[model samples]
Target chain A: MKHLLSASDLTRDDAVSLLDTAAELASVTDRAVKKLPTLRGRTVANLFFEDSTRTRLSFEAAAKRLSADVITFTAKGSSVSKGETLKDTALTLEAMGAQVIVLRHHASGAAQRLAQSGWIEASVINAGDGTHEHPTQALLDAYTLRQHLREGAGDLEGLSVVIVGDILHSRVARSNVALLTTLGARVTLVAPPTLVPVGVQTWPCEVSFDLDEALVGADAVMMLRVQTERMTAAYFPSVHEYSRRYGLDSARAARMPDHAVVLHPGPMNRGMEITAEVADGPRALIVDQVANGVSVRMAVLYHVLSSQEGAP
Target chain B: MSGLANEPAVDRAGEREIVLRDIRLMGDRQAVDIRFADGRIAAIGATAVAEADPQAQILDVAGRIGLPGLVDLHTHLREPGREDAETIETGCQAAALGGYTAVHAMANTQPVADTAGVVEQVWRRGREVGLCDVIPVGAVTIGLSGERLAELAAMAESAARVRVFSDDGICVSDPLLMRRALEYVKAFDGVIAQHAQEPRLTVEAQMNEGALSGELGLTGWPAVAEEAIIARDVLLAEHVRSRLHVCHLSTRGSVEVVRWAKARGIDVTAEVTPHHLMLTEELARSYDPLYKVNPPLRTVDDVHAVREGLADGTIDIVATDHAPHAHEDKDCEWGAGAFGMLGLQTAIGVVAATMVEPGHLTWADVAQRMSVVPARIGRVEGQGRPLAVGEPANMVIIDPDAPWLVSADQMASRSQNTPFVEHTLPASVWATFLRGRPTVLSGALV
Candidate 1:
């Protein structure tokens, strides 16, 4: 794998191999050395055209653990805002010996454009893009799910997952829907009519407006962040009304099966998408999802860089 | 209107008279000879062969199809602003190579061609270039702001004599403004060509709204946004009893609405771009801005509907919508890239590949839809005339058997943003004549 741009680009075997490698790499974090020589001579560049502190730090830590040199470039307080194009930034990174570029931009298809534009020879990893796939995020989420539900085995065959809230604008939901279904999991997306996309029926998942009903038979529930701007955009009437319907409070969590776990991709709105009690509860894997993120990214960087080294 | 000179001053002295031998006119089984004198077709068939001037140039077309030159109802020359993308001279050169005799320049320049000064400048530049006749389209709203109407009467009476008015890049979404513009143009026998898009619905629309858009994570441009405006404008035209033209109609629902309006005799004409006829929304998978355009490329089903619409006369003409953008504007990410493609150089080739070769339209229908009907709708005079005695010799000779590849490097336009690059099309424009003077001959610019 030269680039991890979209979760949908992964085959079933490709996804399983990444997960298994991530699981093996997770053990290295427990060791005192906590380092690998796989990417010792490589350089990884985190090119964040948008403000994403958590994701950039996670990738930075991952590259350090793999013994790869890291260079960080952010759009804030930089020449990018003063009219430096994405092409110029990418070329600069490549000139500085960046073998892999982890890009997070505010525009959809920005990562794909970097990868396919023939402007640079670096492999592109999409940390996140505007309403587009974040393949590594989905990978770490899948790795966390396998650790909790599948006992770190093969695919999550026959497992059911319910993803709730803003499916229309959530890149997390888009990537998860593609990656989870490819692993033989049945995924159901629950959101308001206005929050769901017009073509959600074509996705390989069942869609429901009622979060309570969708949680009944689910083995896991992933809560997506609901931006306050959506309220003013008329996607929903009010935050109170949206919470009353889709929020996974203590009451809504009891509706799920006893074995069902809860997951939320970081920096959560405590009282909005999920209640405070539910986020801090024992069943929630939000904290573990972050820790697993580093390991999964290490696996991705190692895979893409080492595979290219063996090429003629 | 600008006056037409009976005898066009030819750049090359003593080359005004010529004899075209073995040219195949549409609907004729055998080839015939045509003689031109003093910028007009002097004779055809037997008389043309008998009265051939000894000093006139004699060229054999080898039975290639000859028809009146194609007329474009929509083109963006980008002069008066954005000359970095294209100029009147470069655009007219591209048009001549594409088998076009005239093109209606769109009104969305830098200062916006809303007044007599801007429109007249564009017209005069084309006249000075002397390649293809460039007719300036006046903006309905000043600066294309979609607010107050521009000086339509002054522009109509100017040296440009604009007959088509449009704020093409930005739709006149205001219903009252559209109605007023449609009614106001009636005094000058003008048509309001509308770019039908609802602003609120398509805030940042990137691609066609469908399953692919959801999967690709790009913003969806719903078909209803286009159909709703077209539906409302057709009703407005009906209420005012005025002529309306829909520019670059790109949806199946839009085709149905235009068909219904035509059935009701609302005096509306619709045009489909060659890109919409051949390309689809699936190209968005590449995330290349070359395929990105306003009224975005739709599904295969919409392609079939537009083709059927063109075949059955429900759609009136095939306008190029030949928009050119500079490298910086189009070579960036998809969202940041400009929404346009070079079309003036590849119009006939795309038409032949998509319409004629598919059996959706014949050579006769091609001439009507590309030339005669567009001229009639835009009220362009002395062009799109039938090829016969005393008619202006503004026509194109095309070789249907010889197919050529579309390479952006070979195009005359200043921009290399054509979506048809590297595509092998079915027809080739061999030669184009503007008032008996060759602008392009032997597939090269004269």
Candidate 2:
């Protein structure tokens, strides 16, 4: 969980190893047992201050499928609904004796606080926090991409993955940029200037506002959901304006390399960020990202809870 | 006669002796008698033509300008959902001090003002708070999901009587969706206020897509993302024969598109934010999250174009997209923070420094854009009225030459998210009136 705070927390070796484990877990999902005993007799709690159905459920299912008891705490109705401080909730959850806590929060550095707060002895997993990162989501996305792209357990040494859309407000984009770069994959972020965050010059990736050029020769394309709510605050103006220039309708989707696939974190603004034709298209790995979410999380829970002696 | 709930409380004992010696009214600067009565302008005329009662509350403003109270078509109070950041009362107080008589409350709230019930709740809260008239903008979509249209007729029929339906922070981006929205609102004599951004092109966008975005290593939100949407929506409005108000029109391309749309006789109106008209991408050089806005600040050319658009009436209003943010939402590194800035209190001053002072817009033009046009777009019956008898008497007195420095400490909004901190700007507001009652006196909220 402490490692879930920032992408800088993980060394290249640790990230690569996690990817490898995800591959192994991916293979295991095809087996008849489907269930893993990795975290047996333990309890994992999902503490999500943010409302993300797919991510929250994936971690929930991952913990349950691993034979570990799962406790779900969403910010919507739980003590968080009382506006009870996250600190108090953390203390309460800690008292309940949770072994691992997968947390998603709206504020950046929230998970980092829970990990470093010394409130509990549980392992931590970052589902996502603000526009900071979602290591597990990035891992699962990469895992899904690698299955179709990298063959025979080969490394993604020289491949390319282009993340397109609202990178400024996206925790998922941040995670994908760092993790993909760490694995030696060429990362390209394509977005409007208003969509990109400040101080991105030092990151290891090529930045392009032009989607047509960014998708050329790309091995994978990750489409982000353009939050309309963020725009009325004058982030950007009008959805028709956003869609006409940036919408990943079928025409733009066809511009990618034939082998390239489309990815989104879900809750898609269909016909706006992406056309229904493409989100439902054959090359779309959105559902795959959701599926791999479980496997990657299962691996994360197992590694963080069991491999305490050689912890990264 | 309404109560003093929306008026600035005049402190009886602390009165001072001063006079507005030379009142600059548009082109001609002349000596005039400006008296305050019941927290309103009881008389205004050439010095020889009018007399001030000795007992009347007198303030010396020898070399200052008095413009009508400013109005904002766009401002997010963040109440009922994120009041930890700002409230209607505090937000309106900030607006009053900034010389605003009315502000349109955006619909992107917790339960979202997509229905009459929610708009009434928000409207009642704003009225009960007694700061300024908060005109609730109905949500364009049901949950702002953009798939279904909201109850335009219902919202229009509500107590707030909302005439503007917008998914402001969220775009009604779908074409068939936008066309239908434009058509739906037209039946009720409403305008569909568009945020004008392409979602797919700008997904995860941070700042303007350019050398700066490359230098900052942040994701680029291309100018085209905004321009493309404006171009299409303007044409869409023309096709549907419905009126469209483009909110916060930034970028030169967007301005040109709006101009072309106007030339083609499309019933398209546009607005520019004080931040966009004044500041530029150079602030991004500081890496401060506060300066990092959505539609990221464009280049100087874009700034000049936005100013010109306003000057030539291509942009019809000057709205302050006042957004308040919690500290944690903006305190982190740019990549890890939310996108927004507080603009209410600093909006007029910023405009005075950037446009009014520079001659791009005279104070008369300022009154039109900031007062009259905004009221027209929002359909506030009594607000932005002519300066004559029998009106609601909403107005402001500006010490246009008053130099002031901006700091977060003076802000009334719950969150101190302004990017203009440390900015030294010309002009300060002396007082503001809502229905003949001063809500701000001597630059302080009553």
Candidate 3:
């Protein structure tokens, strides 16, 4: 609960509690003026050493909405450029009274280092680390589905979702497999051979390459955009060929059940992953995922930093 | 000479005052005086040269020897990105303290040395520091991505004028691709220095794959994983008739392969690092990440084989695969830690104490393995030299008998990642002279 380093450590109740807190936080954004004084006088720092505009901006906005002072620290234009070490940076941030740190770094286990180094007393939250997990994104996706599917609009008991893309380089797939399965939802990962990391057989989900089989009778289909830079020299035949097979075109999107919905974690390629019609269609929750990002991050920040010690 | 008024009295000394006392004279146990002036050997005699000038400096070397300046074929400066780990300036300072006059700066840095721009950046920095002559090793694969060949000809023509090419942190795994690279480098007489790990075999490998890896419960980095590639590359080198330099040769099995290639004259050279020569896999039982390295340390029996291999001329060079890492990068659980340890300042003594005093090697052989042979393998010019008149004064005055304990904080490299920090070793370097000027005096750099 202190640092969301990995999703596999979360229990069923822990996932539900975090999801429920995010729902309450999401409801505040619907008011005439979205603002809260819950985290007043506290300081939250978005210390992103890696590039993720979506995640960085979400935490920044979430901290500000709660009336907490937000400081966004990135690698560019910082003393990190001047050969200062990470522990030194964290100590400097701690000296400035940062209570929570949301960090993303390129090296694997970098987030764990910030938490364990004792350089900063701030509560840590992992935004995304190398080939590891992204906890908040999975929580938001779970919250986005529970609004319609959960019995009391709470826990997803019998829902089904499929995450399709580069599962090897994705922290998103790792986090979702843990959180979605914990909440009693069937999860399937669709990826090419090169796109899957080793030892997925032990993961708590059904991994398949046949997107057609996974698409049938799905309640919510989350299409993960392929990270192109990691492909470096062509992981597949071509982007064009990848889109022709696994992309959520009109024909594939129409194959889902009537109650099914679509989700993507934005910065989408227009004609590649999701076509223009499916992205703007009613079943798509693309925009809502962005909206939900702030709420889930706020809830995560509050849960870790706040003194609320009531439930699991 | 703005500071000419405050110059030292040694420069004022007349000709015959330059005396080389306590001379083993190429590892033969005897005393001799080799006179020199303006940085060259003037004479070799049984008696000391008289002080022809009153202001002449006296170098009283009682029980030591003389050899050529040391050369290292592999050293990671970690500049242009990870300066917290090390920089070329600091690494070169350490190299001088270790009695080296030249070292090859590897290409694995931020924005990698795949391009001519980064290679020049590193090469120019080494010159600006003026510690040692830095031979920039260009990347074989672009960005070290292992997909396509880099602009080798362009980098070879830059100010670095690179001749050694490698994807050193990783292997050029595909044999066909290795052949093409070997064939391509033939046009320019460039050597492909391979790191020699099979990618598929060492996916999660942590240490040397054997009883040690089994006991530690860490993934095994098999010895054959390195040997297999050496086997394939040696034959490939024979076919292409090009030079192939194997980086950080560990294990007795690899020693035999290099020995066979050398006997057959297949144009191959191999280097054993100081750590591999002095330490063994048994040190891994301590569970320190500082002791962790790629091409992991083998057994004591293997250590003897390496020493024997170096002596009998199977191994060509004694490179200090000096790598630096930050505290956070190394001070962690074994499996979660970084690979490599600091080597530059510790190498000479480790080589001397472990080999020189053991009668397995003399200072002459040490000079051959550490400096002369490395200079030939790396094709460095004007670095490793005999004490002759016309050679550039890239040399060192080593005590060769002063015992000293190494401390991590005493090192010039920015990172405290040395594995042999507390160990007391013999044969310390007292001073080093590069280009007729003192760079290191009394074992400290000026």
Judging by DockQ against the true structure, name the best candidate: 1
For model 3, how does the per-residue alpha-carbon lDDT over A1-312 read when each residue is reduced to its tens digit? 777776766888887888788888887899987999988888888888777898999998898888889888888888867766667777788788887788886644557667775556778888876655787889888888887567326578788889988776677777888888998999988877767655567677888888888899899988887776744546688888788877888888888898899998777887777789999998998888898889988888888876434322
* Alpha-carbon shift of residue A130 in model 2 (angstroms): 14
Sorting all predicted structures by lDDT, with the top scorer first, yields: 1, 3, 2
lDDT tens digits by residue: candidate 1, B1-446: 12353233444446647899999986366899998886788999888868777788889989999989889999999998989999999999999999998999999998899999999899889988989899999999999999999999999999888999999988999999999999999999999999999999999999999888988889999999999999999999999999999999999999999999999999999999999999999999988898999989999999999999999998999999999999988788888999988887788888899989988888888999999999999899888889989998898998998899888898999999999988999999999998888999999999
Q: Rate residue B24 of model 1 by lDDT.
A: 90
Best by TM-score: 1
Candidate 2 per-residue lDDT over residues A1-312, each given as its tens digit: 334555656677777777787778777779888887766778888888778888888888888778888888998878888877666676677778776778887755567656765556666788886666788888887788777888625456888998888887788888888787877799999888877766677678989988888888998888888776776866567888778777788998888889888989888989888999999998999888888888888878877877554432
CAPRI category for model 3: incorrect
Better of 1 and 2 by TM-score: 1
TM-score of chain B of 3: 0.91
**Candidate 2 CAPRI level:** incorrect
Each model's iRMS: 0.8, 7.4, 8.5
**What is the C-alpha lDDT profile of model 3 across B1-446, one tens digit per residue?**
31211122345334333555665655667766655555444455643365323544556666466677788889998997899999888899998998888889888888799998988888888878877778889999998888899999888878777889988889999888899899998887789999989888887777786654543334568788899999899999999888899988898899999999989999999888888998888777555667889888888887988888988888888888898998887865455678887888888889887788888887878888888878777667676777665555556666776889889888989998888888998878876765545578778888
Report the alpha-carbon TM-score of model 1 versus the true structure: 0.98
Candidate lDDT scores, in order, read: 0.91, 0.78, 0.79
